[model samples]
Target: MYLGRKAIPLISALALSASAFAAQAETDLKFALDWRYEGPAAGFLLAEDMGFFAEEGLNVTIDTGTGSVNTIPRVASGLYDMGFGDMNSLIKFLDADPAQPVTGVAMVYDKPTFAIVGRKSLGITEDPKSVEGKTLGAPPPDGAFAQWPIFQEVAGIDTSTVTVESIGFPVREPMLANGDVDGVFGFAFSVILNLKAQGTPEEDIVNILMADHGLELYGNAILANETFAAENPEAVTGFLRAVIKGFAAAIEDPAAGAAAVVARDATLDPAVEEERLQMAIDMNINTPWAQENGMGGIDAARLDASFEALKAPMGLTGAVGPADVFDSSFLPAAEERMLP
Candidate 1:
């Protein structure tokens, strides 16, 4: 599930000069993606096709991420200018390497995409909470899977009888269909859509939105190594502005966006991409900040809530603060026109 592109050296000390990036053309802007062609990636794909990055003078290259967790170190070491990752991964980076310096430029999902899907053959949705004794599928005991026990504790999912497997997305559907696994807990934007596309009919799956069970996580953020953001704040802002337009376009016409994505098979998807694009649109378009302010507006309280929520079991009680996690200096102004 790797959608790779030509590798370019990350901009380590890149300071965008007016004469260099200008108001129009910034070439060679490299952004590493968190995963293959997951739905959360639509905005980046849209930006690429519609010439948003080009309009900003960015000759953009988006590479698929090996794992979201590894993005920060690569960015800090100059392997990538920016990378897409979750906030928890960002916090983990600060814990290990405070100097690895990176800040989120823009976020993708306003709320957690985490969910659990059960084999419809079992009539699990007849009573979704019946998942207590089930053996679930997750991405190993990493950050995402480890959260399950945490979720069980708060949601009363009953950990004593539950089991989690970490084989990755490709195996989820087959494992469940064959009864080798009972459920999958991960992003609906990716896993569920992939399941349906793989012939697991909508009626054959029972998706448990973790948010309903008290697990709220924020995923999909565009992050840059601090050195790059610090030197090229304007460029980062322009890039964000362009990407926001990309998201806006994706929401307005997901089918069209899917068409655009398929054009780049290296970073493409048909149903999964389109479905998630619309989902993000529906969720993000109505967020308190996105509503009152506009796109890409980060409300302090929203961020605070997110930080407070993940702090406990993530064991980052006194770890990093808002100042360390995100830097709004490069965020686009809500008044700015988005890529339509």
Candidate 2:
């Protein structure tokens, strides 16, 4: 008697388990992106465009969030199963509600891309406190900027003289270029490139790399609530494995990945996508760390530094610890299936 297709394949299951085979049987996942379908988030676009999630039996819908910080509460409230967010904001959400725990599974950018840009002619230097006398543009006067006082104190800049302007994400560069504000807090990789693209003179800006000034934090992480991760560790691990694989592929060929991003969102301009994708590659996806440890590993000490930076800002200086912030189990499991 001839064995059926299923039985025939089973006979050739060299070192593979039935459970492992079943694991790929059409699992649905809800993933939230750090931003809309654009430049900083190009790795995720490549992941979705290249069918990485589909291969893992995941039906993932990439949603564009209005703000970088909103992705956190969305996960805690069960609005999403997983979200892409920064380390600083993620810690705040997790600390506030231990009842609904969330964990960081992967790191998208090995270093912080966050920074502030000022008018170059001022000769005020890249000091954080120097902006105290000038109008400063950042996320908001509330969220992270309020904590700028702490950062300013640490950096030895006098923020007391700084006038804070709460600019949404879009206005940061334009506001500075048009002389609407003296400086703006933004991602140096994106905002600075954009200003140049839009004909903003190179001489008009002096950038203070936030990371260099000691306000370091990781960006674009994969996070899920503890309940879901606990209930389905394998699924979470598999999804992250696919995410890392997709990012690796994207880094190897950003042009192809950028094209993939364009194919997914036809409304997007190719020139914009290409520029954005290249920026993502340089800043996040293909960093030096990814070359060594793969795309998703975390340095615990750096992570701790981020938590420490945010604690005083969020008014949780003594309320939280690193133990409550990150969970590495999912990332390690994902790393196992990858090529070293």
Candidate 3:
């Protein structure tokens, strides 16, 4: 059917109005990342850049976070619709106040990044016992440092002899590099890479990952404000679906993922960010369990055991359980979540 010349302007005006309405219909979501725009953050960045969120009818705005431990409160306060943060921290937060309006929906880091990083030259070794009688720097707000008590208990470290210095995040790595501290508590990837950037040899760094030493806790996850999730369940699921595609893209091409990160923060080195992204993908995101079961899921038995492990250190009142803290119902289908 052909429109007359007089009807052309009316049709164009109607089309413009429909376009505006469709744009307005998108669900607006504000996401908070646990850390800066680095290699690990490429998934979210790539998803946003690739328009996956747009395809899902979501307008997501992601912001850098200060710390994983701090991200929980940001979401709980309704300051952010969703966030990526430490699941152990979330567990502790929920235990303290079950009514808090936040819960983990997707398990991002299948293996916890919590670790005690030290220099081999400083008498620290791969053995957990090596940290004994050593002074370690710990950032108070760090998620890995928050797990120190639990790591100490599980790893059989004698805290009586180990001295922990409360240090700022900016100074933690520098103190270690300058030999001001024998070791430091941080995410293995972040600490190790930062140390390397500080002129420390890779071979001299010893990363004592808590997960390898019997700490069964999970790591950073996608957290949603309970109120927001309840009111917009479809939006939550759609956001996660877009996130899965982003991760898949990142995993398929790490260099591209790093490029996405560099695009956000030009001060970052492409090579370093690429390596960091690969480290996260290899050690955290693409674990054997995640490879088999797909991403963004948790095992009930493991989560229960983690709650048991966190009981004493976290001072959990038994007010919340694994079910209360994590809701896998919001995750997309297993096939869709599978990584490359």
Q: Between which residue pairs do clashes occur in model 1? A: 25-57, 26-57, 26-58, 28-59, 140-166, 245-339
Question: Per-residue alpha-carbon lDDT of model 1 for 1-340, expressed as tens digits?
Answer: 5434432222322444444556455446678876665555677888888888888867778887755666766776778888877666677568555666787767665565556777777646735467867787776523345456456656766667766667765676677766788887666656666677667778887877666667665655778888877777777887888888887777778887777767666455576677776775665333554555666556678777766766765667556777788887787665773333
lDDT of 3 by residue, 1-340 (tens): 7878999999999999999999999999999999889999999999999999999999999999999999999999999999999999998888888899999999999999999999999999999999999999988889999999898888888999999999998888889999999999998889999999999998999999988998888999999999999999999999999998999999999999999999988999999999999999999999999989999999999999998999998788999988899999999999998888
TM-scores of the candidates in the order shown = 0.83, 0.83, 0.97
Per-residue alpha-carbon lDDT of candidate 2 for residues 292-320, written as tens digits (9 for 90 to 100): 67777777897777776766656764566
Clashes of each: 6, 3, 0
Candidate number with greatest TM-score: 3
Q: How would the candidate models be sorted by TM-score, starting from the highest?
A: 3, 1, 2
Winner on TM-score between 1 and 3 is: 3
In candidate 1, stretches whose alpha carbon ends up further than 4 angstroms from where it belongs are: 1-27, 126-129, 141-146, 266-272, 284-288, 337-340
Write the candidate numbers in order of decreasing lDDT.
3, 2, 1
Q: What is the Cα-based TM-score of model 1?
A: 0.83
Residue 160 of model 3 has an lDDT of 97
**TM-score for model 2?**
0.83
Candidate 3 local lDDT, residue 96: 85
Off by over 4 Å in 3: 1-6
Candidate of highest lDDT: 3
